[model samples]
Target: MERPNNVPLPGVSAARAAERATSLAAHLDARHRGQNAQALIRAAVKDLFRGRIALVSSFGADSAVLLHLVAQVDPTTPVIFVDTGQLFEETLQYRDQLVALLGLTDVRSVGPKTDRLARLDPENFLWQSNPDLCCRIRKVEPLAEAIGDFPAWISGRKRFQNAFRAELPVFEGDGARIKVNPLAEWTGKDVEAYRLEHGLPEHPLVKFGYLSIGCAPCTDRVKPGEDPRAGRWRGRAKTECGIHIAGSMTPENEGSGI
Candidate 1:
């Protein structure tokens, strides 16, 4: 087999990626168990950087914490942002502000293949009826395409986000990619403290009770003491839009509606 980095990288087959992802998951799991969660994440990131890995960001409400961590380690790591065309204006603004303040060197915004959307749902009503299919078209497929050439990518999914994420491992294999959720063990308070201490730019909607901000149409504000993610896809049977793994996001008997 060709050396990992020397092969023709872009558009690697799903099968090949799965193989590497499994190996990466094993190595990370073994090495990180004895270390504290934050230390483990930082160590994993440093290993990726030494091997020239790509770091992905959504630049959402919780994204600042991860971005801040990446900036401390390596400012030049390629940071890919998936612009689903449905994000709030505040998210876009925050993305720019954080990149500049953190001195991120290679930030790129990616979107879905143009014709795919036109063919799938010309009226854009797919989100209203079948949000999973809509998100697959808009977010997942494009992201799968964007990260095809990378061995690893980072995410900010904290375990406290929902029941689906409560037992999240420090490292895991997500089909064709090594999905690294660094802050997997962090609570809500941890995120707030990081932002305050670092003096990071906040997403404008955060103050309006919008905790888990996603596409504009699918998000809303939550009431006090409510689940931060309770506002998304309000009144609909959708906890997550299938961006995260299916089993990892299955809603409880409480029904899927946000």
Candidate 2:
């Protein structure tokens, strides 16, 4: 099973994409077990995943923390933003403002194919009747197609964001990619402190009690003392956009990679 140094590793190649996602996820989890978000970002962008890594951001409330960290580590790193075509105007504007301020060179805006939308959701009210399907076409599918080529990708999810996210790990495999969550341990206070300390721009909607901004139709303003993500998919059983959930990130079976 041992290969010589002259022989190139199969799964590590760019063409192979995420063939080594499981192994790399385990290694990164072990290597950066006790590191902070900044440290994890450095390893992901400059060392471990390097050219094969990307950071996905929603430009939602507290997103500035992870974006700022990734920008500092490597502004040229591919920043994948899933534009579900249902995003709020404020979120769109915030994405632009933050990218300009951060001087990120490779911020890519990806969305569902127009024809796909035309065929599946011409009425545009699918979110009301079938949120899961709407999310699949508008958010999950688009995001998967965007990040699928990368061996690894970073997410801004944190444990304190909601009940389901309370057990999130810093590193885990999502079938096709090693999904890194550098801010998994970050609290709301930690996010705010990082934003203020680094002078990062906040999402415009954050001040309006929209603590967890998402699509315009699904998101609502959060009440005081409620979870930051409580307003998302308000009055619905769905807590996630289906992108992360559909990926089936089983940190439990993987034994908590981080």
Candidate 3:
């Protein structure tokens, strides 16, 4: 009884695939602690380097760790920084310094489309009523469009930084591309150690307790032991501004002129 190669065997069911995905996710999450972070990222780089892989950086308080790693692997790899027209002056300056010191090449600054920004909110006043919309316009939408051609992108997200990121994996599938978090399992201390060891520069705001730096208007400084992202969109019932996700936005939430 010869069996066809492509078809499943007599009793193979869809459940097996679901189980495999779950198992694989769990295994990677569990195994991604400490030294495994670099090992897995190196492996991923090798596997994914057949095409373009951009490192999405904010040059924020904690991004130096991953940026240093990326520089070590391939300085020529594209590093995409979204300059949302509202970042701290220090942040922008830090970005330039780090890029120069790390010898990073292809560091492109992606921003909102010019005409859309003019049509949506000519004065950039949309941050008042619809912060989410402002974010989509200035950050998410532009970034999604910019990265449309790449199959995978690198990020500096760590699990300990936010509740929504508690279960972050080294690799996850975005709607259009894969998101690789090489530092997913790292903690604040780990980042500090890497920075110090490699002589990487930190964002100037970090010393002033701005743990999670985003747009200037939506972000603020935090006290010790507070959630790093506590000050972002402060007094508003928002955790993330949806800049990282693709197409999960609505006109009401992401386009309303608030």
Best by TM-score: 2
- Each model's number of backbone clashes? 1, 0, 2
In candidate 2, what are the lDDT values of residues 114-150, reduced to their tens digit? Answer: 8878988998998898887888788776776676547
Clashes in predicted model 3? 2
Put down candidate 1 lDDT per residue, 83-184, tens digits, no spaces: 888889999999999999999988978887778778776887878878877777777766666665565667778889877788887777665556677788
- Report clash pairs, candidate 2: none
Please write out the lDDT profile of model 3 over residues 1-258, one tens digit for every residue.
121111113464434432443454444445544546566666546553334578888899998888888777778878888899988999999998998888997898988878878987798888887787788788887676666556567888889887878977776645434567788888888889988988888789988889999999999889777788988888988888685553342222333333
Task: Tell me each candidate's TM-score.
Answer: 0.84, 0.87, 0.82
In candidate 3, which residue pairs clash?
A: 129-258, 133-254
Q: Least lDDT summed over 10 consecutive residues: which range in candidate 2?
A: 249-258
TM-score ranking from best candidate downward? 2, 1, 3
Stretches off by above 4 angstroms in model 3 are: 1-35, 246-258
lDDT of each: 0.73, 0.78, 0.72
- Between candidates 2 and 3, name the one with more favorable TM-score: 2
Sliding window of 10 residues with minimal summed lDDT for model 1: 249-258
